[model samples]
Target chain A: MIKIEHLSYHYSNGEQGINDISIEINSSTSLAIIGPNGSGKSTFIKCLMGILKPQRGSIILNNQNINKLSITQRSQHIGFVFQDPKEQLFKSTIEQEIRFALRKRKDQKDIESQVETILECCSLTSHRSKHPYDVSITQQKFILIGCALGMNQDIIIMDEPTSGMDYKGIKQLAKIVEFLKKEKKTIIMVSHDLDFISEHFENVMIINHHQCIYQGTFKDACRDETVLSQGEYKLPDIARLSLMAKHQLCTTHQEWIELWKKR
Target chain B: MAQLELSNFSFRYQGSQDYVLKDINLTLKSGQFTLINGLDGAGKTTLGYALKGIIPHVFEGTLLGEQRLNHKVFQEYTHQELTKIIGYCFQNPWTQLSMIKSTLEEELSFSCENVGYALEETRFRVKAIVRLLDLSHLIHKNPIHLSLGQLQTIALGTILVLDPDVLILDEPTSQLDPLTRRRLFNHLSDLKKQGKTIILIEHNIDDFLELVDHLVLLEKGSILDQGSVIDVYTRSLSIGRDIQYPSLTALLSTITSLDKPILNDNDALTILKGVKSHD
Candidate 1:
């Protein structure tokens, strides 16, 4: 479990990145952080990742303060996928990248088999031997996710994982996410892709104007009209339809289809 | 004139043995908004580069067949001259920044100044673009300090200042907030009305479906299909391929009785309600 208390970060330019924000993330559940562009979502994630030290507040992981942990130690507990794939990917080949992430594991046996499982999960088996840059941008994203999974970190963080991915790539990612959830891993993501969020995440934290405007279930947040203004968000397609339908607030295609079948 | 055409087009990057793009053909007319989409690794970016004149000029490659802009061939126009006619926004907005310039205003005007536009004309165009993109607040700040969304707007601004007749934007709204995405589309719509052609490559063609005159689906470095949005999307879906539609469009398509794809929420509600009544 991870807990944050009154976390705040101010840029050197005197602009506040995030202001006095606090939220608790339970293990085995997904939490999505969303807000307008440049609205402190990334800033909060950075503080959590130890890339940026908070001027105020603290982050405790399993009762130990994350601030005290070294960057390498912090990385062991938390696996991070950067918004830009280029930032996180450096290995020569996709398969090699996953193998590299699995380096810290104590188990000597079944290493190759474990890499195979991760490759299949990421739908990157076909491209295993290919260079990271040779593949599409979306494939690079999966490679990063694959590395994170291979690391076997308790907590996984993805920043804008769905940006350039297409329908097929997204389905593949959703499948892997389901696999991860089954393993009871704590998943956190920051994204502008609302449909993906609506389908996968239950809890959402809305940061706007350098503060947490709302922290609750996505369904509740969608019903709250204030979320739309405070977070500078336009209602996503499914949310808009769900609002207009006024039956049950639906956020996914399956939910919408089921609601239609009822009506 | 102002038409882009390719015939039997293929390209292989200099070092690579395999052709990454193959057997592609397209004719984009003036003022048409064409959307190129497919799954990742489908050579969409390579296709964009081919159309943008970046392929043969910037990247060394084995180019086959022909690419024509207006009545002239690509070789006929110098790289500088091409900028006057075509503005291409890259998939990665960060790379689009002219890092030499510190301030956003200077970055936006770099293209205009480089192209030898008169001082008064450059100022006029830059001002107009800033206003169109709602970028006044960030004009003085260093662009490197801006977020991806802000940088995307500024990157597009850098292209818009050239007053190019055709704009090729790849995933331009990937980082933008929904409202900003809507606003950016609105500006593009305005530009479309003014007779500038647009070629957009994106995974989710949700917000700007109305603006898309043509939809081309790429699969594994080839054209899977190309035509009106509904025809191509529905045809692809029939073959058990997910071409990726907006949530509303996807929802509407689930009902087999719907005559055509609809985007508006109220219309979707009406069609869904009617389907229920018939049941």
Candidate 2:
């Protein structure tokens, strides 16, 4: 479990990133952090990862104060995949890039075995020897995920992991996230893709102006006009169609279509 | 005459035997919202650049066949002239803006300056664009500090100040929240109403189903489909192959089992309710 208590932060230049807020996230629940850009979503993640020192607050992970933990120590408990693939990938070969995360492990043989497993899981075995730049941007993103998984962190935070990907790639990522959920890992996603987010995640947390405004089912949050407007949340096409059907004829999509067929 | 036309055009990057765009034939008229949908590396971007006169100029490629804008050959226009007539906003908003300005007014002026406008004319256009694109409140803030959606608005404003006839945006809403995407589309619709031609390339088809006037699908460097949205959906179903429609289309398709998928959410819902009552 990750717990945030009265968390507040500001940049060194004195612009507030986050205000006094409190939230608790239990394990095994997939949570999506939705908000407009510059809504302290990224800053909050940085504080959770122990990269930023909050001016005031406490971040507790598994009943331990994460703010007091060292960077290396935090890495053991949390994994992060940044929005930009360029920030995570630095090695010549894809295999090496993933392997670098497991460098501190005790056994070399185990590391190699785990690397192969991750490569297979991410569908990157074919390009294991290829340079990171030679591959597509989506592939680069998967390499980053593979590295994060190799770290064996209890919590995974991915920032817009499906950006610039095709529909198939996005679905593949959804499957991967689902697989992670089956493993009971705590997942936090930051994404603007409403359909993808709604289909994959059950919980949606909206961050607006340095405060948590909405937290509940993805469908519920999407229906709120103020939350939808303030956070700039758009409904997925399926949800929109469902709502539209409900509004126009007071029926579900299936029922409406069946009626049209009879006519 | 059509605003832009590409006849039997094929493009192969230098040193590669394969074409990125093969045997392409497309014509776009004025004041139309054309959405190009495809998987990644399917030459959607390649087509956008070709349409906007970026190919064979910025990229070293083997160009086959002919492309014309307003009855003139594409090669006749310089980069500046092409930009003035056809505004191209890239996928990344930051890389598109070159000015180091602290305010919206300054950025618009910088664009005018790059295009060689008089100082007084620049100020006039800057104010007009700021109001039109709704950048009035953000005019004084540093451009770098703005949100992604705001930066997109600024980029559009900069281009609009030039008064381009055709606007081409590559994945404009890729990183934006859904609501912002809707607002941007509303803005695009408003532009369409004002007679601005738009060519949008996107992977998310459902987002633009109702708004896009024409639909084009590219795969492996070739046009797989092209026509009105209904025409494309009918073709996809006719092929007896399950083509990926937008979510609304998929839902309606499942509900209606029709060859022509319903594009509107309200229509789909109404139909769904009728079906439910019958059952």
Candidate 3:
């Protein structure tokens, strides 16, 4: 479990990145963070990863203050996939990129097998020998996720994982998220891809003006139009259509079909 | 006259055995908006580069086709000459930024300076583009300090300052928030009104369905379908390919057996009201 209390970060230029944010995320749950650009979504994740030291309050992960942990120590528990794949990818081959984190862990045995399994899971087995940049941007994102998963961290934070992905790539990512959830891994994602969020994430935290505007289930978030508008988030198309149809809001076409059949 | 035309265009990058784009033929009339929709690695980005005269000019590749601009062979134009006629916004907005420029204003003017615009003319073009893109407030801010959405606008502004006859954008709104995405598309709509030919490679189809004059679907480096928005979307759906459709179209497809392509919210709502009334 992760707990944040009164966490605030002010940039060097006096701009507030996050303001007095407090939230608790239970173990093995998927949470989607939604907000407009310049919202504190990235800052909150950075704070959780111990990349940025908050000016006030504390972030406790698994009962220990994250700030008290070293960078390597923090990374062992929390894995982060940056918004831009270029920011995280450095290794030449995709196999090496996935193995980069495993090499740091002295306890990790059978490193090659672990890398192979992750590559298969991300469906990158065929591209294992290829350079990271040789693949498309969507593949690069999956490679980063594969690297994060290879670390065997308790919590994984992905920022905008579906940004440059096509429909097929988005489907592949959705399946990966589902697989992770089934494995009881904690996943936190910040994305503007509401369709993906609505389909997968059970809970959502809406941020605006560097503050948490709302935190609840996808259903509740969709019902609360004012909060969504204030957070500058539009409902996924299916959800919007569901609301327009005076039906319970749903995020996927399959759900809409089920509802329609019942009606 | 067609603003841009590609005929029997095929290319393979250096050291690649397979062609990245194969037998692709497309034409863009002046002031028309064309969307290139494809799965990842379907050669959308390569196609964009080909249109911008980058495939043959900047990247070393085997080009086996003809591309024309204003009835002239594309290869006949110099790289600098092509820049004035075509502005290409890369998929990664940061890659398009001029890191040498500290401020957004300077970044926007970098292209005009490179293309040899007079200092006074460069200043005038920058001001007009900043205003057109609603970027006046961020004009003085450092490009590095801006948000991803703001940076994307700046990247677009940098290209627009050149006032190219054709604009080729590769997933420009992929990093943007929904509000910002809509705002950027509105700007594109305004540009389209000004008779600027646009070839956009994007996955967010619903956002620009109404504005798109032509839609092309690509599969494995080949054109699978190309036609009006309705025709291409319908064909995409028929093929069981996972294409992003407007929610209403999907909903209508589910509730009713009707396969009619609904492009916008208003049309979808109107049809929904009719269905509800009939029920």
Candidate 4:
């Protein structure tokens, strides 16, 4: 379980990044953080990843205070895929990038095997030897996800993973999320891709103007016109389509179809 | 109105034996809104380079065809003339920004300045683009401090400042939220009414379906499909191609069978309700 309390962070120039906000995330639930661009979603994510220190707050993870944890110790608990893949991708080759993440792993045994597994899962096996920059931007995103998978952390956080990705790439990522869930890994996604989020995640966190305005299931978030307006989000396509016929919120296409049929 | 035509065009990058674009025969008429989509590495960007005159000029390669604007070859046009006529916004917004500019306004003005516009003319175009794109909120903010979505808007605004006849944007909405996207969509619709040719390459076709006049699908350096938006979209769906299927259309097709394309939310509501009444 992860607990956050009174979280606040201000930039060096004294501009508020995020105001006092608090939330608790259970390990069993995956989370999607939804908000408009520059709405402090990145600020909140950075604070969680320890990239940006919170000026005032407490983040408790499984009874451990993350503020006191070392970077290496934190890596054991959290893996991050940046919003821009370029920030996280630096190695010469795609293969080397994934291996670099596994360098600190104590299990020297399955390193090569693990690398192979991630490459295949990411559909990057054919391009393993190519330079990360040489591959298409969509492939670079997969490389980032592969690196995070290589870390094998308890919590995997992906930021805007679907940005600039084709439909095929998005489907591949959906599969990856399923695989992670089956492994019991807690996933946190910060993205504007509401359609993707609605399909995969049940819970949502809405941030706006550097504040946590709402935290609950996606259905509740959708029902609230104020929350949607505050966060600058549209109704996910499926929900909008379903709501056109009925008042109920439907998460998936099949579910919407079932609801309509029953009605 | 300028008509851009590509006739038997094929290009192969230097040192590569394979052609990235193969015998592409197409015409983009004046005021036509074309939407193109495909999987990653589908040569959509390469096609953009070809259409924008960057292929024969900037990229070294083997070429076996002709690209003409208004009956003149692209090579005939001066670089400055091409810049005035065709404005290409790249996939990566950061690369398009002139980092030398401090604020968003200056960054937009830089495009006109680079095209050799006078100070007064540059200012006029910059102001017009800002108002048209609704960039008043971030006009004075430093571009370096701006977020990715903000930078994307600034980058696009810079191109619009030039007021090119043909605007080619590579996934402009990738980073934008719904409100900003609608703003862009509205602006583009207005631009279309002004008779500017708009060719948009995107991974998400949901927002701009109504704006698409023609649709093309590229795959592995070949034009897999091209036609009216509904025909191409329905064909693409039938074949299970990798093109981005509009979510509402996909759902409606799976659950309910509406012969006509479900272009938007209203289309689904009206079409499904009409079908049920008939039954």
CAPRI-style class, candidate 4: medium
Q: Lowest-scoring 10 consecutive residues by lDDT in candidate 3 chain B?
A: B270-279
Write the candidate numbers in order of decreasing TM-score: 4, 1, 3, 2
Worst 10 residues of 2 chain B by lDDT: B270-279
A1-263: candidate 2 lDDT, tens digit per residue: 98899899998756678887688889998888878766788788878888888889899898888788877789888899987688778899999999898887999899989999999988899999999987777788899999988987889999888877777777778778988899899998887776667677878888888888877777667666566666765556656665554442212344445444553
For candidate 4, write residues A48-105 as lDDT tens digits. 8998889899999998889767666787899999878888788899999999988977
TM-score of chain B of each: 0.92, 0.89, 0.92, 0.92
Alpha-carbon local distance difference test for all models: 0.84, 0.79, 0.85, 0.86
- lDDT of residue B245 for candidate 4: 67
lDDT of 1 by residue, A28-64 (tens): 9999998888788888898899898899999999999
Q: What ranges in model 1 sit over 4 Å off?
A: A260-263, B237-241, B253-259, B276-279
**What TM value does the first chain of each candidate achieve?**
0.93, 0.89, 0.93, 0.94
**lDDT (tens digit, per residue) of candidate 3 on B1-279:** 138999999999998899989999998899999999888899999999999999899998789989899889987899998988899999887889978988888887888899999999999999998887777877887887666766877888889889888999999988888888888889889889989999999988778877999999888999888999877777767675566666567657666644557866677667765564222
The TM-score that candidate 4 achieves is 0.95
Q: Runs in model 2 with CA error above 4 Å?
A: A106-109, A126-130, A219-263, B99-105, B147-149, B252-256, B273-279
Judging by lDDT against the true structure, name the best candidate. 4
Q: DockQ scores for all the models shown?
A: 0.57, 0.46, 0.50, 0.56
User: Ranking by lDDT, best first?
Assistant: 4, 3, 1, 2
* Cα-based TM-score, every candidate: 0.94, 0.88, 0.93, 0.95
Q: What 10-residue stretch in candidate 4 chain B is worst by lDDT? A: B270-279
Error of 4 at B156 (Å): 0.4
Model 3, runs deviating above 4 Å: A104-110, A252-254, B238-247, B250-258, B265-279
Candidate 1 chain B, poorest ten consecutive residues by summed lDDT:
B270-279
